[model samples]
Target: SFDVGGKEAPKVQLTKDGKEVKFTSVEGTRHVYSIAEVKPEHQGVYKLTAKNKTSSEETTVTLNVTGMYIIQ
Candidate 1:
């Protein structure tokens, strides 16, 4: 989620591994990105960019998929 204060809402873009990713929701100044199921291929870097007429800001996150375990 992100906050870009003011009347006009900023445009939010999310990318995963250099490819554009779909956003789940965008309410007010908040943006949400959701992946239904996480897989090995889904493990990578993610970037979020918030832009407006005036200024823009960005952030990056890295996700590592070491292993998955099921408890019986």
Candidate 2:
């Protein structure tokens, strides 16, 4: 989740491993992104960017998913 405050709302975008990704967004006082389910394929570096006419900002996070282990 992120808080965006400025004279004008910036355009928000999310990407995975440099590729655009589709996600559910809840916009209000705060911006929240949601992914219903997570799988191995979903693990990657994610980037979030907010851009406006005046300026732009961005952040990145790395997601690592390990395989489940079972014991007898």
In candidate 1, what are the lDDT values of residues 1-72, reduced to their tens digit?
A: 555565556777899989999878877776777778887888999998877888888899999877778999
Q: How good is model 1 by TM-score?
A: 0.76
**TM-scores vs. true structure, each candidate:** 0.76, 0.83
Worst 10 residues of 2 by lDDT: 22-31
TM-score of 2: 0.83
What's the lDDT for all of these models? 0.80, 0.81
- Best candidate, TM-score-wise? 2
Worst 10 residues of 1 by lDDT: 1-10
> What's model 2's overall lDDT?
0.81
lDDT of 2 by residue, 1-72 (tens): 777667788888789999987646646536676666788998999998889899999999899989889998
* Clash count, predicted structure 1: 0
